[model samples]
Target: MTPITEVEGRRLALSNLQKVLYPATGFTKGEVLHYYATVADALLPHLRDRALSFLRYPDGPDGQVFFAKNVPPGTPEWVTTARVPRSDGPARMVVVQDLASLVWAANLVTEFHTPQWVVQEPEIADRLVLDLDPGAPATVVECCEVAVWLRERLAADGIEAYPKTSGSKGLHLLAAVRGASSERVTEYAKRLAVEAEEAMPGLVVHRMTRSLRPGKVFVDWSQNAARKTTAAPYTLRARAEPAVSAPVTWDEVARCRSADPLAFLAADIAPRLQDHGDLLAPVLDADRAGSVP
Candidate 1:
C-alpha cells in the first residue's frame, strides 16, 4: 500500500484514477493516458507528479519528482504542491514544502483542456451553456428555480441538457446540439442565449462582458469551439466546502439547495468517467441532420 504522504498521495491518486480510467469506454487507457499525460504536462504543469497528482520534470529524456522547500507552515488541503509540469525539459523531482504551495499552484491551471472525453463532441452537437451565477446576496435556492425552468424548456425542445456544478458558485447547464462548425456553433449558441433570455425575462443575461453585467448570469458561448474547454465534469475546484458539480437529472434540478457549482471532488469524478464513458462521444458522431436542430 502506498503511504498517504503528499508524495504517496499523488501516486495513489494516479493509481486510483487508473482504476476507473482504465474502464472508461470509447477511449482506451492508451488514449486517456495520453490525454492525461499531455494535459498534465502542457496545461497543469504546476502540479507535481507525486502524492496528489502526477507531476513530471524533464531531466533530459528521464524525469524528476518535484519538491518545495518554500511553502509556509499550516496550509490547507488544496495547497500542498509547488512545482508544476514545465513546458521546457530538464525536469527533476523535488519535494513541495507544504500544502499551501500546492494549492496556490493549482489556481494557475484554469486554462487547461477539458479532456476530449468529458464533453459532448462539437461535430455532432454544439453546446449552449447558461452559466447562472447568484451573487453573495443570491442564494442557491434562487438558482435552482431557474434551473427547473430551464430544464423543462429544454426538454420540450427535444434537446438533452446536463447540469453540473460550476466548481465555483453557480450552475452550468450544458445542452447538446448537433455538431457544426465554430461559426455554426456560435450562431446556435447566440440563438439559444436569446431564447433563454427571453424565456426567463429577467433572470438570465446574454452578454459575455463580465464588467458590464457584474452580478448577472451570462450565457457563455465560448465553450463551444475546438481548443476551448470548460472544467472537466466533476472536477474538484479549490474550495473548502464540498462544492462540486454533482450530476443531476433534469427533473432533479429543483431539488438541490443551491447552484454553487462546487459539488464534485477528484474522487467523485473517476466513477463517472467509468460509467458514462466520454460524454463527448455523441457529439463526435458528426451526422449533420441527426445532430442539428
Candidate 2:
C-alpha cells in the first residue's frame, strides 16, 4: 500500500519511499522527496512560470531512464500545467508552483528537472546562459578559471551574472536580460563566446567539437536557443551519487579551482542556502535586468 503524507495541508501519496535511488550513497526515494520539500521555498521560485521537462529514473541511477516533455497522463488536476505551442502541436508541461506540485513530481522519481529559459512564451528568452563544459583531462577547475574570466568580461559590459554547478561535470553561468527573441539571445551568446575564444586563444573554445576540448573549456553559448533547456538549479542530478545543481558563490568558484571537482552535493545545499540565501535570487529580479546587445 502506498503511504500518504500531508505536506502543508496537501495530501501527497508517496510510493517506493524505501527504494534506493542512489546505490553509491544509499539515498532513497523518500529522501529525494524530503529534499524537495525542504528546499521548496527556494526551488519553487525558479520553477514558477517555466515549462518543466522531467528526467525520470524510475528504478535508480543504474536503471532504465527516460525523458518526458509533457506532464504524464493521470497527473492530478490540482497540479498546474501550461500548454505551450510547439512545431508539432501544443504540449502541456508541468509548472512547479508550490510544495504540493514539487513533491508530486518527486514522487515520480524525477531525477533532474530542466526548464525553458523563458516564461510563458516558449519562443522568447529573458536569461542568457553560458554552459562551461570541460572536456576529458580538463576538470571543472579549468572551467572555473574560464568562468571567472568570462564573468569579468560580462561585468565590464554591465551584466550581473550568477554561477552554479551543472550537477554533473560542468558549470553554468546565467544573467538576467531584457525579454527578447530567442534568436537575438542566441546570437548575443554566440558573439560573446567568439570574443572569449579570441581573448584567450587556447584556453576557451566556442565550437562544440570534442577534438578541441582537451585542456580547455567549451563556452556553450548555444544553450540560449529557444528549444534548449538547462538543468534547473537545486535539482538532483542522476550521477552515481546524488549531487545537486547547486548555486555557488563566486568566492566558492575561485576556491574550487584547487579543490574537489564534485565539491557540492545534495546534502550541502540546505546549509549553504541558510548562509547565502539564494545567490541566484538577483537573476529573477526585474530591476537587475541587463541585455546582451
Candidate 3:
C-alpha cells in the first residue's frame, strides 16, 4: 500500500518514494516532493491560477520522456482545472492553486511549466519572458552579456527585468506587465529580440532557424503567447542532476565569468530562499508592472 499523507486537508497517496528519478545523482521521488513542499510558499504564487503543463519522466531523465498539456486521467477531484480551446477542441489542463496540488503534481513530474496568463484571464498577460538560449559554441556565460544589455535596454524603457537560470541551458529574463494581452506582449518581445540582434550582431540571433543558433544566443520571444508555457521559476529541471530554474541576482549575472557561476542545484535553493526569499517576488506584483513598450 502507498503511504498516505494529508496536506492542507487533501489526502495524497505518494508512490515510489524511493524511486530514483535522476539516476545521475540518485535523487528520489520523495526528495522531489520534499523540494516542492519546501519551496511551495514561493512557488505557489507563480503557479496560482495559471494553466500548467509538464514533462514527465516515468523512467528517469535518461529514459523515455513525454510532454503533457492535458491533465492525465485519475487526477484528483480536488485539483482545479481549466478547459482551454485548442485546435482539436478544448483540452483540460491542471491549474495548481494550492500546496496540495503542487505536491501531488511534483511527485509525478520532472518539470513544472506555466504560461504568462492566468486561467481566470487567459487573454491577458501578467509577465513577459525572454528565453536567452546559448548555442553550442556560445554558453550561458555568453548569454549573461546579452542579458545585461537587455536589462539596460529594458530599464531605459522603464521596464524592470529579473534574471533566472533556465535550469536547462539558458537564462530567462522576466518582467511584469499590466493589462497587456499575450499577442501584444509577443509582438513587443519579438521587437526586443530583433533589436538585441541588431545591437549585438553575431552575438544575438532572433531567428529560430536551427543553423542560425550555432554560435549565437537565440532570443526566444514566442513563449509570451497565451498558449505557450515556460518552466516555472523554482521548478526542477530534468537534467543530469537535480538542477533548478533558480531566481538570480543581477550582481551574479553581471559578474558571471563562466557557466558554473550561474548553475544552481536543488540543494542550493533553501539557502538562497533563506537569504533572499523568492528573488522573483517583484515580478509577481501587478502594481510594479511596466507597460509593454
RMSD after CA superposition, every candidate = 13.3, 1.5, 1.0
Can you write out model 1's per-residue Cα lDDT over 1-293, one digit (the tens) per residue? 42223432442222221222212232222233333332232223212222122222212112233423223343344443333222353222222233333323332221122311122222322455556666445545556666677667666666666676676667777655554565566566567767777887566667766554444456665556443445544333334432334454444456666433335544445555566544433333324212434
In model 2, which regions exceed 4 Å deviation?
116-118, 259-262
lDDT digits (tens) for residues 17-74 of candidate 2: 9999999989999899889888888888888888888888989878988888888987
Q: Write the per-residue lDDT of candidate 3 for residues 28-86, one digit (tens) a residue.
A: 98999999999999999999988889988877788888888998889999999998765
Winner on lDDT (2 vs 3): 3
When summed lDDT is taken over every stretch of 10 residues in candidate 3, the lowest stretch is 83-92
Using all chains and alpha carbons, the TM-scores for the candidates as numbered come to 0.50, 0.95, 0.98
Best by TM-score: 3
Task: Compute the lDDT of residue 197 as modeled in candidate 2.
Answer: 91
By how many angstroms RMSD does model 2 differ from the true structure? 1.5
